[model samples]
Target: MRPRLLFASAAAVVAALTAATAPSATGAPRAAAAAWDSDLAAAALSANPAAATASGSQSPELGPGAAFDGNGATRWSSNAADNAWLRVDLGETLRIDRVTLDWEAAYGKKYVLEVSGDGTNWRPFYTEDAGTGGTVTAHTYPQEVRGRYVRLRGIERGTPYGYSLFSFKIYGGTPAPASTTRANLALHHP
Candidate 1:
């Protein structure tokens, strides 16, 4: 049997995306913003490429846990072993509302989720004792909780050790104020 997500989260994600861009009462320029959900794992790259650089990630990548073995880099999982991570930089303060981790049936173990603004001061989001590969665990973060970066540490994988992945979605929260044309120009100038 194929593995499945712990929650019907994909549906919920699509719904949110639809709602955000639906339209407003003003009937003016409210601006279209990408919903936290939806099929945005790719679009997120364009929206925040610098974030990828900040997290040491590449394009078209779902989460952080890619094959970074070339540099002999040590991962959070095992030493000289199987493990991966998908860290994200929010670019600005955001009240992390929800998080979803998707993996393969091969990862029938467990792991941890941590968030931080300064990157040094960390806090645990959730610690699942058991995980079946192909499941997605969704958890609501503290409403007042805020951060600029999120690091998914695959501390442990399922029985048959390996990495499982598809994507990681950091759900809704308010984005910072609208950026002006002059500000955007200044940012590009170094």
Candidate 2:
């Protein structure tokens, strides 16, 4: 049974890889090749509700949820402090491939992206020592990371104000189908 489960997992991974690399009938790669190219982060996941929070909000309208609300006009602004941070809970563990920070005029000059399973202990996977203030900035890791909580900690501010973000997005985790997880569980428990 254990061997069968292992084989099933391996087969699924191989199938996904094959599908990602297979060419079209015209003998040309698919236009969305980046979707399957693990080297590039090509997909974006919707921000989970009630999963965002900040260390300190500058105003009620500029709360943490505003950044995840899909509106560029709304933003989350923290108090004027270098230790400001914002976090998002993904609800469950996911294979995070990339993170995008849509910044306003205020941004973090130095920040670290940390991930954790229980939200208590975090592991910093990516760090921007010199972040440039811009409308949009993206970071892709060399390999995917599994975590339920993602946090951005500001070490330095680009402006006199605290960190401000119009939106924070995470990409690249495809959850297994319900049937698949059930089958895998049966195989291991039977």
Candidate 3:
């Protein structure tokens, strides 16, 4: 019985992976989902491979990707007008407690971090009208949240200019990273 159960589980995993990886009706949507799922699945694999193998929702890659590098907030473009925002759909639920914004280019320095249970509605984790250093310092907003959608609203650019990006990451887990910070309070870029 035990052997049969293992065999069944293995088979199911293989089937699921195949199905999830399969191409959908349209190329773009399917590709996006596959890409997002792949990233989440990849992250989970390192944390827990077996759990990664078992979980679904490895579809929908509606998120941003980094191109070049920035020494300090120098990569974000200032072209985003009002309501013209970029967002990240992590593609799965994560127990996120903190979000760190590291801008290498130093242009899109000051930012606001918002988290949502559903992508449609978001609450602030950190907000800044004016930001601080354009260098390599981590601006952290600490909160206990389980969300699939995380968004960064670029309030103001570092050095009063907006550029592009190199990489944007969402760091999370149980109990959260060991740190001290206030809840939902506005902070300046230092």
Candidate 4:
């Protein structure tokens, strides 16, 4: 009876350790799920032209606008380079929650999602080193991240072609007006 009790205790300890170190369904560390919030970023504006700049576009029609046009059939393709990237401006500082990327056949296998208040400074929000191609990927933040700009920096392309996106969606947070006028305040208050 004493030996049985000791064996049971050891078994429980091994189980606990295995569970603690297990990988999640997404093939990411269990801790990665804790860093993500399930909320979507639909309220965001594309803000690509005024707030965004890219490494390069394949053509005018296939430029950044194609990715934000809300049509899944059209896409934006970049020049065949590992360093190509696309950015979107939220116009004002917002609590960013999620980002969805609809990839074309030409996708990014290694990339980083970053945020910035000023276009020049950037901080990584998420990273995917073994990304699968031709899929819609959504990344959510566990906590609110305040920023004006979001960028997808491609480090490795999945195909001989450059990185291509069918649609890029940013969601979450309220859009802050640059300045509020007295009339606007009165209208809401009244």
Maximum-TM-score candidate: 2
Candidate 1's displacement at residue 63, Å, is 7.8
The ten-residue window of minimal lDDT in model 2 covers 36-45
lDDT of 1 by residue, 143-177 (tens): 45567777666656575544545555667656644
User: Candidates ranked by lDDT, best first?
Assistant: 2, 4, 1, 3
TM for candidate 3 is 0.46
TM-score of 1: 0.54
Candidate 4: which stretches are off by over 4 Å?
1-49, 175-190
For residues 26-102, could you state the per-residue lDDT of candidate 2 as single tens digits?
89975332332232211222434568878999998898887777677888999999999998887667777777788
Q: What is residue 170's positional error in candidate 3, in angstroms?
A: 1.1
lDDT of 3 at 109: 45
What lDDT tens digits, residue by residue, belong to model 4 across residues 1-190?
2322112344664575477568878878653111123322222333234444578998877887667667788888999999999987766666666778989889999999898999889988888999987665554646567787888999999888999998887766644343333333332211
**Model 1 RMSD vs true structure:** 16.0
- Better model by TM-score, 2 or 4? 2
lDDT of 1: 0.52
Evaluate residue 21 in candidate 4 and report its C-alpha lDDT on the 0 to 100 scale: 67
TM-score for every candidate vs. truth?
A: 0.54, 0.67, 0.46, 0.65
After superposition, candidate 2 runs with Cα above 4 Å error: 1-48, 135-137, 175-190
Query: In model 3, which regions exceed 4 Å deviation?
Result: 1-63, 67-84, 133-142, 174-190
